[model samples]
Target: MTTAKTPAAASPDTPQPHPRRWAGLAVLSASLLLVVMDMTVLNVALPQLSADLRPDSVQLLWMVDIYALVVSGLLVTASALADRFGRRLVLLLGFTVFGLASLAVLWANSPAEVIAVRAALGVGGAMIMPSTLSMIRHLFTDPRERATALGIWATMAAFGGALGPIVGGALLEAFSWHAAFLVNVPVMLLAIVAGLFLLPETRNPRPGRWDLPGTVLSIVGMVALVYAIKHFGKDGPTDPQTWVPALVAAVTLSWFARRNLRRPDPMLELRLFRGPAFTAGVVTALAVSIALAATMLLLTQWMQLVQGYGPLETGLRTLPEAVGAAIASPLAPALAHRIGARTVLAGGLALSGLGLLVIWSWPGTLDYWAVAIALGMVGVGLGSLAIASAVIMAGAPPEKSGSAAAIEETSYEIGGALGVAVLGSVAAAFYRTHLTSEELAAEGVTGRAAHVAQESIGGAMDLAHEMGGAGARLAAQAREAFTGSLEWTSVAGGLLMLAAALLVWRLTPKDLDLNEVEH
Candidate 1:
């Protein structure tokens, strides 16, 4: 446990590790957990939210997606502000907004109101997300201490994500879906109080003047890119609507990147990617997020709708993954010190991919054991995210920590957004293909019923229950179709993770040691 020694020497001007750094990490990790958990809580709450709000498909999609889309758009700007101001201040303000937005759900009777609340939460999330990383960089000056801190930080992030559905499901059982939103209030309030007293204030001493054009380009480009991905997922790649935004994103983002490169002090530190370890860390965060987002969405629905588990039961079943993540994440750093960072980081990705692949090719009839095994594997591999965070934060110079944090958080947001939209789109496409109108008609389901059945497994199941005697056939077919799509989605995510593992493997240094401090 104490293998890595403290820094051997330091000059008079060198900042010592914060006296309350461990306590400070708790506050930082708690805030980050709240933000990340919001990303996935809705996955479990969606059906209930949909039942109450009765949003049309597009409106329903936004209810689920707007939070991530908004956060992705604003993350860069928020990080820049944190660096310019004080990280503690930005974090405290974020807590207020987050609490207020969650409270706003009390009056959110309609889908539009709920969407508005989610968007506000997104703004708060963007502010809170990167500051945790930057603050951790600011807090622990010693490389070894920072590595251990990052392990705990990654643990909370991954655990919160895996635990969201469980918490949401439990909340849904005892209260309305609104409870899912309301639960954030007390935690945020406590965090604000703790942050005020315990957290240290830190910011860039020489943050240059803000770049308005770069800011505008980032918001526009990032929002457009997220929308295009969502559009592609919802409407397929062939649609001109999808490509229009894609083109706009490419143009604006290219300009934004060029602008960053040209400016002496860019809005984002695009230069961070020049470091191999940093690049690998960002890649790991993004790739893992994409797979995790898609898997959680598919699995939540599969368990609830196909297997007929209630929300709470479904949430409880998700615990295997969460348990695995909880166990693996914190231990990763010590493991990395032993075997090397590249092995833990890339190996984790590979193991996670293999886990997903196992699900894709479950032997004989699929059952709980198969899903459990795969989820545990994915969780253990996900533990490598601690290493990913350690590398990303460690690679940056202390002054540019905010930029490094922003890039890392941005990768997570964008990756999650794409995963839910793209891989989810692929799954939807497969479901519709497998559950065709012809097939519905053969099952004595035709007209609007056939249309509904072909639309989504959720719609099919709901309509089938309404059809009474004729429902059994329709329900069975829809479940099978959805299960098939889940398998396909899992395989796609598995392949993506495997590809990412190789890329990061190539990018990470062979002789790298995480215990060494980066100046």
Candidate 2:
């Protein structure tokens, strides 16, 4: 009887690292830092931009979310293009676009104009995200080296998260909100220059014909699905406005799946999901993102609104999470070797869930130390998923690494968006539930004023400034209500994370060893 060959046996030397792989990693990690920083940097700029541009609520929301939506939607197509043309070429092209788009912010005086610039940035981001991972695959052919490289890459991402608020805050202090966008210019220029020298051009030698129909379906379905999820979370699931896109997404994605299954050369290799390790890795990527994004949102609001810290203080305080993540990133892979990837992955998620539960069960008093410790736990938990990303790329063939990267990036982007929409809705609901808005009426605050106070803690605080003595009562009530919302939301987030941990544990293969997988 004939047997299939193992990957290492078939190509024993394929896992060796390239001569300049470390140099290449420096370039790739810097590029990754740039992309991820841009993702978070804009959050600080939003209030200032809103004031200057005078965007209404809807436009403001779009300005905040559209980049992610567009990035998630286009990842698959961009990855496919990278596989066809050249990963390095697509990467450089993305840098050029990203740099020029950053420069475009100079003229962004209106909401519509800023939205257009953000859309361009999104396109560039989609190209850059997947290419970086696939290039890592090309640079570090050995499984152990690749794992270490991914650890460093994960560290860079954590560093970027830490840097975004601090960097943005300092820039906003010294200059206008435009400084946030303009900051990308010099970084991209450096990346583009270094990348051209250090990065190798790699592509799939036997790439299939670009499936245009599959491309369209993937983009449309993803965009529609995210849109439906966002609207459903915000407007309630019963809203008919969400139904159309949800239905379209289901139909189109279903059709797309059927076509891929029938095709000899599909855009996405669905068969990869059959591997328990890949499935587990993908799920880990998705679930961790949801948990991380939602909990971070909660902490940010609590620090600024409840603890009364300025943006700079809040940003600095958030550094513990990054420190924890940086410390844990390399440790996770080492731990995985001693225990197992399954144990480490599930354990990390469970620890994070426990941390969230701590916040949920906290008494009414705000404890900064407890919050910081909890964030550290979440960071360590999230740090373990660096191995998950390694598993994702390791399972795929060298040529199809781009496709795997695309899927991983898509999971992360969509997971973050889902986290915000779902957890934000839960928090908002609890905020409304806890607030006794009618009490404001007894304080001679009725009609428009009462309604405004009931809308948000911010609204209530603003109304309090005008109402003098009644404002203090209203502000106090709003803070209490908002705190209650945080508690309940943390409970929900913790439970979801626990369930995700269980699911990932169940999905992960018993014999799986990251160090032995692809190499």
Candidate 3:
């Protein structure tokens, strides 16, 4: 059983015993693992789910995007609730919800049911993430110790994200998509049991009552904004369905900001942005997320379509990237110490940009080893950014810790969605322009069928097989178009990363010791 020790009793100078510290690390890692695993686990399973459910486009989008949307929108509120209530209590409730939702997903036969369950899973994820970070904040009061703990935490998170596709591929081969959702059940249960036994209870001693209006406004604003972005990506900005929600979201968020300014106990204190380190960290998080998400989405398509790798093989090949990330994450803190956060962040971004450039310069002929090296560089850069950003956020005051963590997490979620939408659209546009008339004729795909196929890489693959000889030609052209698009996209990504490096170099402070800060 875990024993409650006062912060004074477990001072930074007088460290906790190795066993206790390691146990705490385990608890944090378990919570983070759940969060990271859920992020990408559904990707490989989406095809199977679509086949089983036969959802319409919108419903399918919801099935894929709702989890992230809900988690991103609710994170601030959930973190605040945890502070108001208790971290341990919130964690338990989250774990229970996640476990139950996993079961619901397994049992769900309808698209609507699956969407609802996925949304529930998002809520659980929102609750778990901030609490995990906050607990880490409390557990590792020493800067050196905290860095080590965070390294382990960051590695686990990266590993879990990479592991999702691999695990899903294995499950897909052996069983079905249902196995992917079901796998979470046993893991969640174990985490719950272990957390209850080993985790210490912590709470904000002076947390104010929950701000109902703030919560409502945040959720409504985020949902509206995300809906608008999704619609715009799918149908363009002039689409009434896209613009209306976006306009409404802007108005509501403005109102929310005004309301927060007036309230003494705001859900998220706007004052946190005054800190340059925190602000820089948030921007870095968002940019890194956009890069990672876009790269992964494109790389997966490239592997399966152009490279002709099966799902299992694609997953295995991607493991090198994860290994590189896992190795790099632990070195972040030391690098930061040697060169300062600003320098390290800038260098990391530059490395990422170079990696993307490598991909952009890749010849049409596929080279697995070269591709792997490029991807590994991208992973290393991201891993460094992830660890550094976490350290910045967790170093904030206890009262603001939850909100800070939420902001960082929100940046990632929104950035990821934006990346996919923007880069995916770019790819689609290229695919359309490059489609030869001969190719279309050969595939027996014309007009709407051809249009649909060009709109998405996945759709293209599906339509190609449906058509005959001509379809094969069309598919090859489409794949080549996608590769061309990826090359340009990578160039754009590299430029953005370089810009981020410059920004971080200018903005982040030097010699700031996170452990010395008061809650």
RMSD of 1: 1.7
| Model 3: lowest-lDDT 10 consecutive positions | 1-10
Clashes of 2: 1
| lDDT (10s digit) by residue, model 2, range 455-477 | 66666776788888757877788
TM-score of 2: 0.94
Candidate no. 3 TM-score? 0.92
Clashing pairs in 1: none
- Native-referenced Cα lDDT, model 3: 0.75
lDDT per residue for candidate 1 within 246-309, as digits (tens), equals 9999999999999999989888989888899999999999999898788778899999998889
* lDDT, residue 29, model 2: 91
- The segments of candidate 1 whose C-alpha lies over 4 angstroms from its true place after superposition are 1-13
Error in Å for residue 307 of model 2? 2.2
- Candidate 3 regions with alpha-carbon error over 4 angstroms: 1-19, 436-443, 514-519
Which candidate do you rate higher for TM-score, 1 or 3? 1
Q: Write the per-residue lDDT of candidate 3 for residues 1-519, one digit (tens) a residue.
A: 123333444456554533466686797797688668777767767767777788877898898789878887888788888878888789888888988888886678899999999999998998888788777766665555666676677778777878777877788778877778888788888888888878877777777777788889898888787777667767788889889988989998898889877878777776677788878887787777777676776776687777887667777878877887887777877777676667767777888888888877876654677678787887788677655655566447766677777777788788887777776566656666777545665667778887667666667877877766646766777787887877777877778888888887777777655444344
Off by over 4 Å in 2: 1-16
Which residue pairs clash within candidate 3? Answer: 398-519, 442-470, 443-470, 443-471
